[model samples]
Target chain A: MFRPCGLFDETYAKNIAIVRTRQHWILIIIGLFIFLTFPLYLSGRILHFINLLGITLIAVQGLNILTGFTGQISLGQSAFVCVGAYTSALLTVHLNFSFFLALPCAAIITAVIGTIFGAPAMRIKGFYLAMATLAAQFLIPWMVTNVRTDLTGGSQAMHVPAPSIGGFVFNDQQSIFYIIIPITCLSIFLIRNLTRSRVGLAFLAIRDNDLAAETMGINLTKYKLLAFFICSFYAGVAGSLWAHWMRAISPDQFNLMESVWYLGMIIVGGMGSVIGVVYGVLFIKVFDISIILIGPRLTSFLPPQLAQDTAAGLAPFTFGMIILVFLIFEPRGLAHRWEIIKGYFRLWPFKY
Target chain B: MLLFVQFLINGILVGGIYALIALSIVLIYKSTRVFNFAIGEMMAIGAFILYTFLATVKFSLWIALPMTVISTLIIGFFIERLALRPLIGQPILIAIMATIALSLIFKGIVFFAWGSPIICYPERILPGEATMVGKLFLSNELICTFLITISVFISMSLFFRFIKTGLFMRATAEGHDLAQASGINVERIFAVSWAIAAMIAAFGGIMLGIRFGIGIGTLPLVAIKAFPAVLFGGLESVLGAVIGGLIVGILESFVGGYIDPKFSEITPYIILLLILLFRPEGLFGLKRIERI
Candidate 1:
């Protein structure tokens, strides 16, 4: 059991030499990041960005489960998140329910919808699965706007009031920040521990090879649906928080673009790593927010008309370009890059 | 009955436009097995080019149309080389995301280059509606639509049938490895496929602009509509593309004419979802499981 403690066989010995770092170093890096981020939260310019980062981190966690764990590709994760957002918003605002009451129900409702939509999973995988999700992307938004127009507020956007607890209102952006950050941290910890457990192992097993896993007596349907449920449940939680944080719910927020951003977070963050989700969200979302702020500054040298034209367009273009550049050259992402820097220190003076 | 015929005429005209649009998607997938999600945006870019060239540069249609086609072809070829070629042996999902990213980038770039406002394509053809076969009403726009559709169809059919360049493209599309083994330049052929797809998209966009005038704000939705057309016809077959386009166009027309005004607009996509549930392969599409 302690063989990976630099006392292992040939393969692990070589790997550990490369990857294993003193635990204190990672702690320091994380600690430093938190310290830097703490000051940003104090500033007004970044409160909204930080809150968005928190919600995105949660959404990426859900995606990490589907893509990073179960090997499913979904472009409709935003739709599931929308499901949770609308459900929770509806419950809290119209039904006069509390966040605590609405949150679980929201997650449950999203899970149920995810599993049902995921029923097509038995027959489809890869690009076919992608197409199916694309269908869901079109379907849910259409349903919310067209069929359940009144309830979903159609395209007019719905107001989700600030969450209240007992007698206290978690009203402002700062208060919502407190709620989101802790939930994000808790989810990260829970997913990390959960993946180490039997359920997580099963998901990984299924991801690696469904046939092999099934022959080992893992029920493919049960486990696959469970993954859909769990993954989507996480999306629900993220959505509920976002609905409250933004104090609004519009189909625009859950458009296909957001889904692609979430996928970018997973791929560019480092697939199959919990730290990847957080890093991906923070790195991408922060860069995105920074671009919105700094894009015009860079383009200020350009003609005034040109600068105005480039402002709205440059952010999405830069994001897509970054994703392309990173995917082509740095598929392992920032988490893996950070791992490498730590490795150089851990292996100092050992020339191996 | 006159209303039905009028809607049918409009449907077929628009359907022909959609057929050209879906052909871009089908052609790319045929050779490379990569679904080019950026086709609609490519169409939008073409429309933007033509829109700007005529309105801003005051270029002739003959010059502007070819210019748009050539530029878009270059863009598509570069995208394949820059975004997709590196991901050659990577999973299909990477390619899908790459193309999706390309689509987003295209949307962003176009949204930037051409402001997001809706720019109508100025009417160039003479204004005259004609009564054909006693009850059938035809216009210069409809005639142009028919002519463009037929010419595109004939040229493509001949290109694949008789042209050596077309043969190489078809071979590359059919299977890259086999084409490579047969001494064909497979990578070059893939680039050619993208160029050809872009050309078709450009043609479609120009035609649509000429027919309905380009609506800049709603260009993204054009590709979104084309998806269901591809869904109806099966993603891989050329004939299926035409058939699917016509069916969706006609069905949508009938629904818009007879059904509730709101629901009519959604009829095509709703039908597409229903068709997908029962026949995932689509009409005239070969049944394919996930893996070979």
Candidate 2:
């Protein structure tokens, strides 16, 4: 928050408000207007990327809550996303449920599963918990492949019908944008409120020091499970969105590597901040998309096979390098960088 | 009963390889508190180096093995100096992330060099036919893999027991501060452990490539399989790692043989979760009581 010279807060509402000043509110409105209208001038490909960004933002938000706030690390988040995707896909395909109804149901189912897996967290922490979550990463996909192949489509890609309401199909990028944007906004809004509420405080407490937090009357098991439930819920919702957007689902889509990507995203962004999550997602996803688009073009001089291999390798190589650079140099992530930039502008030409 | 025995023998052979990989991970974790997520990638690198020497250079197996081990040691030393050394005093989680990043970097390099295809070693290098043991037939490569892994593990055990550097490593694992105060070069020990672990991984990688054919994905999967063993044996115990590897191997074999084969893939992870739930420190790990 920036305050001009001699500026003062006269009321509790003004002092505690997230949107502190009239200018802040105006900027927020402008930001929302631009975000909502982005599909109007952007290309279909860009819009597709934006839709992907929206979904990832939701999933990474869950990670921010668990890892960022609650101090619990999950390497199996992709598994929960898979659960959500498969659940939503299975529901829409088998029961003929609408996408609107199936999305939340999938998230709820994923939350339940997450909670069951999270039960072990009270007993194990750190690397051990990571292994536990890693089990989720391996086990969920195995189950999806092996059990009731009829429902899961059995290693075969299951087609997801476009979410339709009253014969209006959301098959195009713009239509999917409409369905995705509102949910993403609402999720961000809800999570923003969540981080400010008592529950959010509890999560922060647990993260800072769980033993101390427990001594201070925080129910470690209950809150830990809650964090898992919420985090996986977000992952599930994102998975459903991704499935419906792509119109196909497979077990390979939610592998351990994807889970690592999400981890890298949070680390590169600010771990505990919502704005940080957005920055991290945008930076990493744009880089990833560019690698997919530009890698082949850049490596075309090599033999066809070699070029293809190099192009495929470029994404991971770049991601690995970026993560190492950021962790070693800017451990606080892009959000911290943003704060520094803002601070510079706020006090331009004035050494404070 | 004979059939069961045959599967048991097959599993032990494979388990030896798992044990070697697990030993590398355990060594790194013991000395430096950093879980080397990239151990599998190191295995792949080691295997590829050997593959180059044997397949492209047409060197004899005897000549290729030492070359691979030396190359792996240099690579491991560079990795520690460049990637891991900076992360020494940082948070444990950050160090872990460094390994994860290193894994991706190594994997990307390997993928670029080798592509995705499985590279076969020349048949003349290792015997192609299986040898009969009583009523059971064991493949020649499996026998070598078993013997090589056992020999490596036994040597490592001896190295830790009697060698001065090994004793320093054990002291470092016990307490870095105390080790440093006692005139042990902890940083050097950390680097040495990484180098030794890398060589072991390379050896295991070569053995696995000989048995299964060298592939980009083979060692990473094996590395992940090593996790259950690490957890089962306690992350710090060398003997525990070996025993854990054998147990996981036998369990996997039995599960594949008696139950569904698909279940075999996940049986180790299931056992890992069970052990974690009941004993988070692991079966052979020393439990530290935390005082708030």
Candidate 3:
């Protein structure tokens, strides 16, 4: 909220505007332009990465609202995403529903499932709640794999048809980028606005102290479950995008480790901040891609027996090390650092 | 009736190891208030270290077992000092995430050292013969495991009841500031708890290795299976952890035998969800009263 010394808002509209300064508007416009036109200039590999990044960003943003904002730690987020993916995949494959129709249906179903799992949150809290959600992580996948093996393809990969809009097929990464990036932008916009609303304030209240929030007459049950609903909705959207993007789906795609990685992303980014979600997802995704790129080269320097293990192990090792470093040294995360840097710029040439 | 008894006995034996692993988790949680998510990896690494000594270096069991315990204790101590100590006053989420990170780091280390192979101990740690109780056959390895687990329970109980260090740990668990005020080194207690927890995890891992052969894939899953037991017994209750482990193990055995083999995998988590809904405090855990 810090601004340059000479910029004062004379009107309420100008004061409340998210894009307050001319520089902010210009930066937003230019950033959107570059992001929208990326496929035109960037290589296929980078575009593919961006598409995946965009989808992951949506999922992490939802996580920020739940864990970061509402103070409920869900260890089963990827499981919720799995529900969305499988639901969307099944709707298209069996029921012959349009991609457009299936996406929302998938998201809604996932939200319902998430809410059901979150019902236990009403009774338990902290580590116990985490364990309850952890049950969802295991049980959902088990159901997907074993309960209806015939329908779900039973631990085997179920092929998802490429999404099409009246003969314009989104068969490749570049085409899917069109679907992923815009939705990512819209999701960012909605979540940002949502966090600034009355509901968002209620979420913040509960997160800070649920018991206190209840004393303040903030309806705890409604908001907590609502947060879970919205969180899973975002995951459902992301999962649907993922299934369509990959052209195949499996229970393995959304495992417990992926759930942990999502939590790690939000933590690294800074919980309770939307821009932080962007920073966190981008940081981790880039780190992951770079590791994959560098892994073979780094492994070649080691002895052959050690090489294979190093190649496989380095990514997780470094990832864990980074999370540990962040938790220890920068627990407030990169967003807090960004705030400090912004403050420095705003108060330029002044010690205060 | 005979078949049911056989499954029940088998369940109790396997449950003994589950209880041991759950105890490791409960120990760290009680002392430091940090849920050690890396418990599975701790168990895996301990088993691997034992495997290296017994199989790779061909050290005698006498030397290898003690060495494994010492190395794991050091690992646990350094983990607390380097990773967790800095985040002491931070939020609970940060502490939990730290353990998750530790789990990943430990997992990566296990992968780096052992790769993916299922390695067996060079010699059998227990007798292989199954003793027949009428028509029900009980394996010697399992009976020994149950006896060892019971002895461990006894020793741990006695240690907590009688020993000075154990008393300090109890005091620290009750309240950090209060313990420090009473001349107890709270920091040392945290390190000691972690060390002991790691050693216990190693014991569970070694016991499991004796039964199934140590594999990176399966050992961690076993720890996860123990989670329900931890929850069922109550997070803070050693008795609860033991009883919970036995119940979950028996439940899994029955489910596997009667219902389906696959259902057994998720039975613990199902119980976890059920416990959270009906009795979040667990059967033996103390019910905390929150005040504003």
TM-scores of all models?
0.90, 0.97, 0.98
lDDT per residue as tens, model 3, B1-292: 8889989998998888889988889899888999888998898899899999988998988899899999999999998899989989777788889999998898788878887678888887675577987888888877876787788788888988999999998898888999999999999999999999999999888888888888877888888989999989988888888899899999999999999999988999998888888988888998888998
Estimate the Cα RMSD of every predicted model relative to the unseen true structure: 3.9, 1.7, 1.4
Q: Write the per-residue lDDT of candidate 1 for residues A1-352, one digit (tens) a residue.
A: 1122355446755553423456756886798578446644487546767778878888889889888888888888999999999999999878999888898899899989987777667765666667677777777877778776777789988988888887889887666777888888788878887787788889888888877888888998888778788888998998888888888888877888889889988888887788877888888887887888898898898788777778877877888898888889888788888787777677787755
How accurate locally is residue A188 in candidate 2, as Cα lDDT from 0 to 100? 86
lDDT of 2 by residue, A1-352 (tens): 3455777889989876777788989999999899888878889988998998999899999988998888888989999999999999999999999999999899999999988888899888777888899888999999999999978888999999999999899999988999898999899888888998999999999887888999999999999999999999999999999999999999999999999999899889977888888999999999998899899999999999999989888888889999998888888899889888887887798876
Top candidate when judged by DockQ against the true structure: 3
> lDDT tens digits, residues A1-352, model 3?
4456677889999976777788989999999998888888889988888999998999999989999999899899999999999999999999999888999999999999999999988877777778888899999999999987888897999999999999899998778899999999999999998998999999999989999999999999999999999999998999898889988899998899999999999889998989988999999989988988898798898887778877778888888998999998887788888998988876779866
Q: Return the top candidate by lDDT.
A: 3
lDDT over C-alpha atoms for residue B16 of model 3: 88
Clashing pairs in 3: B233-B240
Comparing 1 with 3 on TM-score, the higher-scoring candidate is 3
Candidate 1's displacement at residue B141, Å, is 3.5
Docking class of 2: medium
Q: Candidate 2's residue-wise lDDT over B20-51, tens digit each? A: 88899998999999898998889888989988
Q: How should the candidates be ordered by TM-score, best one leading?
A: 3, 2, 1
Error of 3 at A92 (Å): 0.6
Collision count of model 2: 0
Off by over 4 Å in 1: A1-41, A205-218, A301-304, B122-143, B211-216, B289-292
